[model samples]
Target: MLRALYTFLIVAVLSGIAIWLADNPGELVMHWRGYEIRTSFVVGVGAMALAAFLVLLAYRIVVSFIETPASVSAYLEKRRQQKGFLALSRGMVAVAAGDAQDAKRYAAQAHKLLDAPPLTLLLAAQAAQLEGDEAGATKHFEKMLAAPETEFLGLRGLFIQARRAGDRDAALAYARRAFGLRPQTPWAAQAVFEIEAAEEDWDGALKTLDRVVSAKLIPRDDARRRRAVLLTARAMTAAEAARGQTGEARKPALDEASKLALDAVSLEPRFVPAVALAAALCAETGRIRKGMKLIEDAWSAVPHPDLADVWLDMIEDESGYARAERAKALAARNPENVESHILVARGAIGARDWQAAREALAPHAGPSASELPTQRVCELMAEIEEGEYGDRGAARGWLTRALHAPQDPHWTGNGYRSARWSPINPVTGEFDALEWTAPSGVLAQEEVPAVAGKAEESVAPAEKEEAPEAAVDTVRALEEAGNASEVLAFQPPLPDDPGPDDEGEDDKGEDRREGERKW
Candidate 1:
């Protein structure tokens, strides 16, 4: 509304001025080339207005003429730029799709049509990498590095290339540079870890791991586990370096290892490798009792072969009667354990107690139908028959039963076979009573048969059988026959076909295995 009002007022003013000019015409004089002429006011005003209109028309014509070619050129250039960008986008898509040939074609076309943009160079580099053209990839990456806009990507590419080429120094250099450029980069930290580990630079690896943890690149627990492993490895390396040196020199390494192992165990209590190492170091430093206690505690919480071995080492280091007594004590602690039983039996055999050795394996014997326990029984029977007990007939019977038994069974056989304890000795064609104890756990009481004349004659009046009563009688009979120790050996029977809960226990074992580092 206001604009219309302003326009009306301006038009009225112009009309008034026109009327005034028309009504009050003054005489006007013009001079040209020294000649004078006179004309009326209305005619001169008309002439001036006509001249102004003509000048405006001429200005419009000149501007249109000047702009036509420039506008057309700009339109063509914009179209060319759009086409180049479209090809570049397609090339990027092709790279993502792993179509190296198509990516290369589009990339080259885009490069030719447009000025060499960093994105185009990156696409070409990726295409070259996919095609296994390492040299071409490297060249493009280097070109990208020359431009500040693409330096980070170029550095990453160079690092990857160095890694693929097995150039550790270059790879490390690039990775460290990348990390310096961006400390929170996951790839850079990971690359640094790989490089440091490869170089046996555990300290550096550990520092990198800390960065990874701080950045939350890896989970905290995972970082702890990895750091523990690296620390353990470094400890081992340090120990190895002191190998030829004097005891004083070796002590520090061993002490360091023990400290590392303890730290690891503290971080992850069930870390068996650390437990074993710490125990071993403790034993080496004349702290065998402490080591034994640590190992025992760990074993009680979670069983590991290494812990058992460490315990055995401690036992073996004892001398003469002390060693024998230690073996028996360990055996008594884990009466059903095949390993402990074997160790005790070996000690007994060394002491020349043939009958005791034979008796020690009694709990391992079972009904002939089962392969594993029967095999262990047969092995013991054979040794007794051939060596000390001189019961060849019994040995032969047990051996025949063992050989006839199925090689595989639903239970027990897995552990038995893993120990590789055959019922009959391969070389002697006899049973190895000594081998019966090699299995890891205590012998099951059901394995041992009832001894003759253990109970008085029974009066039998035919009556309905009671299943629960029968089971009680069987257990009582086994106990009366001195097989109660075996019956009570393990925690309990594990359910068949265990589920996720059961499988998670296996992961604990796996974690320990992962922590172990071989010297």
Candidate 2:
């Protein structure tokens, strides 16, 4: 509003001045090259204004003529950029939708028009992968690797391809290169760790594990546990290498092994493998007192068969009774432990004390004497019956019970029970995955047998009608269980029946006696 008011006032004043000049009747004169020209003041002003307008018009015409080609070029460039961006968008959509042909088509257009190497290569590689063209994918990945920004992605793609083709060496090479390029990359770090572990490169694996832990790729506790396992393995290997050495040659290796073993035990006191290794190393180095103390501590924490085995190995040459006494002492440390009870039972068996063995395992055997027996408990009972009472039937019954008993604990890993501990799983190459746990509840359940001669028992007539359905289910379960074992009926021989080898055995005996008499 102020600007408009100012403009109105200036225009009114300029008009008044022009009017005054016209009233005064003044003249405008010009002379150029002896050519004199005269006009009224208003005419002169009008002429000047017309000349200025003409000059401006000519200037605009010249500028338009000069910029025509550049303007057209700029418009074309803008159109090209639009097309490139559109192609890029289409290529991304095609990749998402799994349209290999469309993706490849749009990727080529984006490559040409967009002039972006990373996006072009990524799209082309994805399209090739969608079409199962590994060579084409690899070609694009190689191109990506040439650029520093996309090198990590390219390395990862190539690494995956190598692993798919079962080329471990190539995979490892790619993983190492990628890790060197970007140590903080999670995939690169994990790949290096897994490959090093699979190859049994303990030192390299430890370094990779440390890197992974520092990167926070895995939890702190998991890293510590794995480190403990790796250290234990290292110590055990070093100890073995030092076995035949003497003097200074063996001193360093044994000392390092013992230190690593102790560190492992301290990290995880219940880790039976490391405990056993530590005890064995202590005993081998004439540290008998130290070894015994280590075993006792481990037993008190978690009674284990491996610990018992290592303890027994410390004095393997002792008599059965002495061995039994030593195991009893160990078992006393953890009386409530199931494994401790099992160890006590084993010791009693070694000492030929059947009652003691039975008493040791009595609590876990369910309410009945042999009900719900564990595998080891059943085996022990079988041995006891056979050795003490000489009852073949009872022994056979106990052996059958063992087949249906809960599985015994061992060095279990990846659904398998190994006889010994190793740094890696034999099947899956998993590190420190094994634990002293039972194999029960993993596979098919064990089948059970019904009591013999149960058909002679009669049901109560009063309750029969009310419990018919339940009784039927019970009978069905028994029948199914019996069928699982599939006991073969022992048919008696008929009067005319004779085995195929009966005559041969009789003829051989008669001829052998006659030949011996003749000789």
Candidate 3:
């Protein structure tokens, strides 16, 4: 409404002016150089508007002519860039689709068209990798290193190639450079850490792990576990180096080893090896009471053979009876543990207590069809039969049962099973991967046995004149007269066949995929 009012006012004002102009009959006149010009006010205004329009049109035409060449150049450059990017995209897709030839063709076109070193060289390197052209891939990766933006990418590719070629030193160098360039990158950190660990460079690996934990690359629990394993490894290394040394020279190494072991146990109290090591160091330092207490506490929580070894070693010169008593004491601490029963059985064998040994192992005898006895239990039974009864046939029968018994727990990590403990996995080269447990396919095996069930306290008649009756039932199978050979009649079934072997498997290509560059 306001715009209409303004238009109306302007029209009224124009009408008044027109009326005045008409009434006055206004005109403009000019004379110069023997020429005379005359025009009305409205006619002159119309001529001026027409001349302004012509000037604006002429200015636009001149500017357009001047800009034409540059516009054409920009359009052509944009088209070239678009085509280069399209080729690069196609090459990546071809690589993903496993078409080496098409990937190579597109990569060459992209390399020829694109000026970006990282993008174009990356495509070229991937193409060469697909074609198994190591030389070509190496050249492209090397060229990428010349540009700052692609330096890390180049280093990653070189590192992977070195590893693939089985050049450990070269791989280490490349991994170190990559780690130095970007410490927080997971792949770089992992490569550096694993290589350092594999080389037995404990200090370097520990430093790398520290940085990884600080950067929160892994969970806090995992970091703690790794640190504990590293400390334990350092302790073991220090102990190994101090071997054969005597007097003051040995003390320093043992002290440092003890410190590391103690710190490891502090971080992971359930780690049996660390506990055993710490206890041994305590014993060496003449802290017998401390060591004994550590062993007792550890046994109460989790009984292990390592702990039993250290416990028996504390009184190394003790009599067989005394050792058996000590083993019995250890078992008393962790009465429900299967290791406790095994330890008691071992101690009984040492003391030549056939009845005690047989009784200790009888509970774990092959009775439950679903839950198989451990290899340890079967072996212990063999020992009891040979030493106590002097029966070779019975011992042989136990050996057959042992053949089919379930395997005992071992150090398994990253799908790598080892018979001995290591701070890192030899297969995956990962930290803290070696955990003390039974391997896969035995997740449902229970620790407590159904046969031997619970400990039933039996007081020797000598210790007390009046003792309560022990409710434990003795195994009649092995307790029969020497004339009875039927107890040895049964044996476990044989293991499944692994099928035929291929003798040419050794000639196959290495299965290490980590040593390859891929999209």
Candidate 4:
């Protein structure tokens, strides 16, 4: 409505102007190109209006001519940028697809046109790395670092390269710089952890881990697990350092580890490494009862092989025979596990239980088995038969059976192989072979009676057994035996006479052990 009203007003004004011009018939004059002419007012006005329209049209034509080149240039530049971006996108896709050749080609093209766009440079570096072109990768990464906008990317690239090259010092430098720039970044924290761990800088690693946890870069659960692993490693290092030192020198480190282990166990009940390390440290510091309690608690939660080993180590002097018997009982709890069987067999051999050892090896023998278990069983059986059992015929038969058993790829006519098994000794912090030797002709006798009656009697009848009754009985027995109080009482004792140098070493070891326990 407003637009119509404005249009009406404008039309009325124009008509009034035209009427006045016509009615007045004023005189007007015009000059053009060295000539003079005179005309009535209306005629002059009409000529002027016509000339004004022509001038306006001429101005429009000139403006169009001026803008044409700029418009064309802008259109072409836009297309170039689009193509460059497309190449970059394709390069990233190629990298994701693991197509190294295509990724490199597209990355090169993108870089040529885009010239160190951070994302483009990152892609190019990754592509170069994939193609094993370390120099090229480094150059691209350096380019990224040269620009302030791409500094973080450059740092990350350098970190990756350093790690790939096994240069812990360089990696740590890059990682620390990146962490300083972006403390909350998960990659930065992870890189720092790796670098510090590689350098055996346990103190630095623990600090980085704490930062990672505080920032929530890693989940609390994951952080604790990692911390515990680191702590265990650190504890092992400290233990090795104090191996031949006086007890006073080693006490602090062991005590620290014990505390860390206790914390770790509280955080994650099933953390075997922390439990084992803590127990070992406790025993080392003469807190044997405490260490035993930790081991027993962990064992109840999960029957870990490490726990058994730690328990054996602690009780070796107390009663090797009793320890072996305890291991056998533990093995009975998890009959289907290969490791459990192996441990039980080993324990039985240690306890001089020849018959029991032979029985344990029966199920794991023959041509359908591996060499490691078979060889271990055979060796133990041979020793028993030749020395104590006095059954050479039985030993030969068992050995023959083991020799004919199916070969396991994991065993090279040697001991068992498991990725989960750490070859490094916790006490020594060094790689050591756990060798097993089998004498010739040491196999289980085919005529031996099966211990089926004992097995059946040991396990409660499925139909008649009351689970709650057994559980109650167990609880009552534990309560009566003061096991709970015993466990609670096993805290590490702070030494009253910690020497000057011992104090620092103690804190360092404790901190390291705590880190591992957190892990």
Q: Measure candidate 1: CA RMSD.
A: 16.8
- Per-residue lDDT value at 77 in model 2: 83
Of candidate 2, the 10-residue stretch with the lowest lDDT total is 490-499
Clashing residue pairs in candidate 1 are 336-442, 336-443, 337-441, 337-442, 338-441, 365-447, 366-447, 379-423
For every model shown, what is its TM-score relative to the native structure?
0.58, 0.73, 0.76, 0.58
Please list the Cα RMSD from the true structure of every candidate, rounded to 1 decimal place: 16.8, 12.9, 15.9, 19.2
Ranking by lDDT: 2, 3, 4, 1
Over 368-431, each residue of candidate 2 has an lDDT whose tens digit, in order, gives: 4544777567767767765765544445455556555665665667744555677777667677
- Please give the ranking of all candidate structures by TM-score, highest first, separated by commas: 3, 2, 4, 1
**Global lDDT scores for all candidate models:** 0.63, 0.75, 0.74, 0.65
Model 1 residue runs over 4 Å out of place are: 1-73, 93-101, 315-519
Decide which is better by TM-score, 2 or 3. 3
Number of the candidate with higher lDDT, 2 or 4: 2
Model 1: weakest 10-residue lDDT segment is 493-502
Maximum-TM-score candidate: 3
